[model samples]
Target: MGIFDFLKTKKVNDETFNSSQFQNEILAFALWKFNETNDYYKVEKELWGIQDFDLSEKQIKIIIEKLKVFNEKKN
Candidate 1:
């Protein structure tokens, strides 16, 4: 099995950890890429496929907030 194959296992209540986990992983990957590129718009477009162009400090904060929310929601 793959390293992350454990994600498919049944939890205590048999509930599946679905897309939320996957989204959190993707967001983490995007964050790592953002650190490298430092181009929010380009990283959003290339990594997350978000068609946003607001490259302001507020936008960066929003992205970070999204990552935090997704991470917190992850089991």
Candidate 2:
């Protein structure tokens, strides 16, 4: 703990805040599209940038579950 440590800490917090804000923006857009079309699959696939991914079955199931929960909450 010394002079300028606060600045370093603040910088990390700012970066984390910015990242969270950006993620929220993307989620808002995805949810908006989902509400319009009721297409969580497309929203997850396209908006999540997983169209080209080859995820394992377990990973996909987890993703689907998360999306379902997200959609349910929105509704």
Candidate 2 Cα lDDT to native: 0.55
How close is every model to the real structure, measured as TM-score?
0.38, 0.42
List, residue by residue over 1-75, the lDDT tens digit for candidate 2. 988755542212334424766446545666676778787777666554534323444443444565677878867
lDDT tens readout by residue for model 1, 1-75: 889966553321212213466446646766687668765566556543433222334444555567556546863
TM-score of 2: 0.42
Clashing pairs in 2: none
Backbone steric clashes in candidate 2, count: 0
**Could you list the CA RMSD of all candidates, in the order they appear?**
12.9, 10.8
So what's the TM-score on candidate 1? 0.38
**lDDT at position 44, candidate 1:** 58
State which candidate has the highest TM-score. Answer: 2
Scored by lDDT, model 1 comes in at 0.51
